[model samples]
Target chain A: MPQREGSPWRGLNVVFFRELFDHLTSVRMLVLEFLVVLFGAAVVYFAAEQIRNTTAEDPFLFLRLFAPPGQSLLSFVVVISILVPIMSIGLGFDAVNGEYNRRTMSRILSQPIYRDALLFGKFLAGLTTLTICLVTLWLLVIGFGLLRLGIPPGAEEIGRLLIFLLVTIAYAGVWLALSLLLSVVFRSTATAALVALGLWLFLSLLWPALAQMLGGVISPPDIRFAQLGLPTPDTLAWQQGLSRLSPGTLYGEAVVAMLNPDAQSMTTLLAQFQGRIGSPLPLDESIVQAWPQIVSLIAGTILLYVVGYVAFQRQEVRA
Target chain B: MTDNVIEASALTKRYGRATAVDGISFTVGRGEIFGLLGPNGAGKTTTILMMLGLTDVTAGTVRVLGHDPVREPLQVKRVVGYLPDTVGFYDYMTAEDNLRYTAALIGIPLADRDKRITSALERVGLQDVGHKHVGAFSRGMRQRLGLAEILMKDVSVAILDEPTSGLDPHATSELLEMIRSLKRDGVAVLLSSHLLERVQSVCDRVALFHSGRIALLGTVPELAREVLGGGYNVEVEADGEGLALRFSEIGGVKAVDQSGPARYRLLADRDVRPQAAAAVVNAGGALRRLSVEEPSLDAIYNHYFETHGGQNAAA
Candidate 1:
């Protein structure tokens, strides 16, 4: 690499603080934050109410606040998985293109700092905002669980919840990075935002079903499994691998491993046949099971960020 | 250390197959107001961007304050402030807040920022409206705010691109006065604009750009002498017998033409109003109006382009 004259992160703090202030105070962010809080509290409250009556002597009762059984569709994890992308995209879809449209790109770039500081600072700010939101939502769920269940969570439960929170942040980072990449790639804010939302819908809501079909075609079920009306291991593994390509799927699987300690592996059906049901694995084992998913989420975030950084650095500052 | 703060030699910029700025060279001296006069897409803005290191220099080199702009952009940008064609600010931010943000970017100390911002705003006649949001500012006010940004930086060089492009005459004049003051403070000012006449008064020297090249570069009078063949037009309105002949006999008078019944336009090497008036009176003619028209950049540009087959020289 050629040596640059000064630090590439010269004005990083300035850009970061300015962007952070803007994001925290903006009306759009305020609306999104309010929506997430409202939905999160309602889901956690319902989960707590059901848990209070259903499970009397459960060891990981508090972990169910996030991914409560029998209401998987509207649990805290499901709400976060669906809403985090929207929130991240909302904060980032116009991060760079908005500067171009407002005619501020040239003026800002003309400052003493390199373009690296601007792109990096914006990404950091968006991630920081997501962190603040996710952390607040995490605290709210735990507080609701405390108030409704009338018992302090075990240390293991707290550890699992903390891990879940970090995984959620990594999940948020993925969407933020993707939206920032879209912002750099598209010059028009409307187009960037539409494309980001379109991708989010396809990856989050539609990709799993498509992945299953593609997996089945790629690896037809074995004759023995077909006769027994069971999916072959190859077809199931292919489906899981293809679906994990989506950030949302990666986040969902990671959170399941963190929040549901009984989730032994990616092939949960196969793990169930091994005769270890209702016995939660240790926290370390859960982390080991979730390690690949977490790494994939973080890697996806960095990959998107690097792509956006390259595009931003090469872009002309005339606009 | 030299008097020339900005030096670009054989500077060229090419975008793919198209050249935005062909090989052009010029120098801006300390405290001098240098104008880049060109029509749209004539590479004036591109040239400015290259000098500020906002765009890559494709072939040749540019040095601001003796440091190469492309390589030492941070050092160059620290001392050189740029005002883009249409300067923009955060609409939700007050003017003071916007300046503070820029000051932070420049790494100005907290104790000095408020004082510098206030003084800069005062210098630009925008002190009273510092608390107002920039969204409500008029185009001219925005331009002044841009100048205030430069002044706040206390930069040695200022690059303003089309600073007076969209301003009213009054605003334009006020802005030009501010530019002159910037020069008075010993700051080198490099401003680009197509409003030839408006910027002509403030420019110490101008480079006329056409088709990504400097077709003419000098003071207005020097350009007029080079292109229009004469630097002065002495108009004498009088009625007399043999008046045109009498005026032609004066020193430095090249040609004489009777434009109206009592008016004669005399092309001269210098201001010959007094001599022309003497000739008309000595010839027993009543001199109605004797006026001299100085060389104008507008006329020189028109003449140069007209003779050079206009401004259409390939993309």
Candidate 2:
């Protein structure tokens, strides 16, 4: 770096640290983290209490805290599915346009750093912040589970939980990259945030409604079966396939199968194999089951991030 | 072995169908204050952006510190620091914090960072207020803070885009003085200002930009002589009733006009201070003041635009 003869990432460290400090101290990030952590911990607490009172034998009891343990009070997975997108968007929706609006874009570009370093650093910094936030909440849940259940998680349980933590981070990264892409595409931070939040609403609330309609067209369960209140297997498969397209659903599927080893399969086909397996599967076996869902989540995150990076690097700084 | 800090040849920049800068060429040498004199939208800022490699050159090439900005932008940026026309910083951070972040961006090592930041603040006269938030700083102070950033980078050249813009007369003068000091420190300074009178006092050489092309390039004196067709406008003052009539008869006097009791304006093709003095003495009147001046830059700019048929007036 002293001679400026290396890759463009030579200035990446400086950009990363500066952005990390900025995100850590910003009022927006602090407020979002507060809401997410408080709500996340509350859900895990209720779920942990519900699992403690279960009469049936559950081998992977600690993992059951993430999936629904009892009543419909919203499991930890459901809370995160609803909240992580908001938190990640809050962290990144102002990444590029905010700098341009403040007249700081030219000044930063004037430094020895290339556009690659700046955009990459910003995305990594935001992702790292998300990772730290998610890990802390995961630890809090484990701690609360230990206190309530009086049973420590075995090594296999810890390994599965660690993978779950990584999957959640990858899931948050997708929203963060999508938000960063919006920030680069829009010139105003308000517009970027609005569009990102609009997309979030579309995925979380409206998409499900639309999916129900599209599911009917893709696999009509036959109007005659509707009178018997029994849908065909085509409708069930299409509905599951449609929901799998959402990152939230991808994350939920991956985590539930990997975390709860007692889950034999992720589809209605589970009824065929339920009586065959009487015990929980090992951590590696469960990961093998969830590998496709995990790969899709990671690939989706990388694709979104690369799109943002390329768009930002191609952007011109007029000043 | 080259003396130039920046050399741009056949530089052109276009946005869509509109060309912002067209086939311009210039060189900024060490310790020289080169000014880009033009009106708003004259492509001065675009040229600077091209030099900094912040924008792609639509055509042509530019070499900064002997490295092509397009291909070796990091090396070029390492040696050249740009202070934008209207600079901004992280308003929530203190001045020191802002400078610290910039130092990191430039790859300044941690061991030398504190000392360098302090000296840079002291150099820009911001040391006393380094702890203050930038949001509360006035426009002029922020401008100086921008300078501090360049100084901290310790670059060989400073490309400032309208550095004196939006400042009061006093602040403008102080900034000019600061730029002068930078030149004394062996730093090549290239600044753009739309006002000729302001840059005339600081620039050693200037390029007059009209419609994205250099209409004229030379020292201030050369431009004055070439554009106004050659001469000195000499004003002579005496306290007699007939001195104006007598002073008009001096040698090499092209035209003469009388203003008051004894004041006469003589447009002389050569230096006529001595001949005019002799005539004023011979008029048997008291001599008070004598002034000689060349044609102003404003006149040269107007003549240039008119001669070019006003093909591309910057509106």
Q: For model 2, what share of native contacts is present? A: 0.73
Mind giving the per-residue lDDT tens digits that candidate 1 earns over A1-319? 2355899999999999999999999999999999999999888888888888788887889988888976878798999999999999999999999999888888888889999999999999999999998888888788878888989999999999999999999999999999999999999999999999999999988999999999999998899998998889999989999999999889988888888877565656656886677678889978888899999999999999999999988888888
Q: Count the backbone clashes (under 3 Å) in each candidate.
A: 0, 0
User: For residues B1-315, what per-residue lDDT tens digits would candidate 1 score against the true structure?
Assistant: 778999999999999999889999999999999999988999999998888888889888889999887888899989999999989988899999999999999989999999999999999999999999999998899999999999999999999999998899999999999999999999999999999999998999999999899999998888988898886999888888999899899998889999988889999878899899889889888988988999888899988878875435543
Off by over 4 Å in 1: A268-277, B239-242, B278-286, B310-315
Off by over 4 Å in 2: A1-5, A70-73, A218-239, A270-281, B230-232, B240-254, B268-275, B292-294, B307-315
The best candidate by lDDT is: 1
The sequence of per-residue lDDT tens digits that candidate 2 reaches over residues A1-319 is: 1243558787798889889988888898889888987887788777876776663567778778877644444788788878899999999989999888878899989998888898999999999999988888889888988898888998888999899988888899889999999999999899999999999888777776677678888888887778888877678778767877788778878987787676665643553555546567677768877888889888988998898888887888973
Candidate 1 lands at a TM-score of 0.96
C-alpha lDDT score of every prediction, in listed order: 0.91, 0.85
Error of 1 at A221 (Å): 2.7
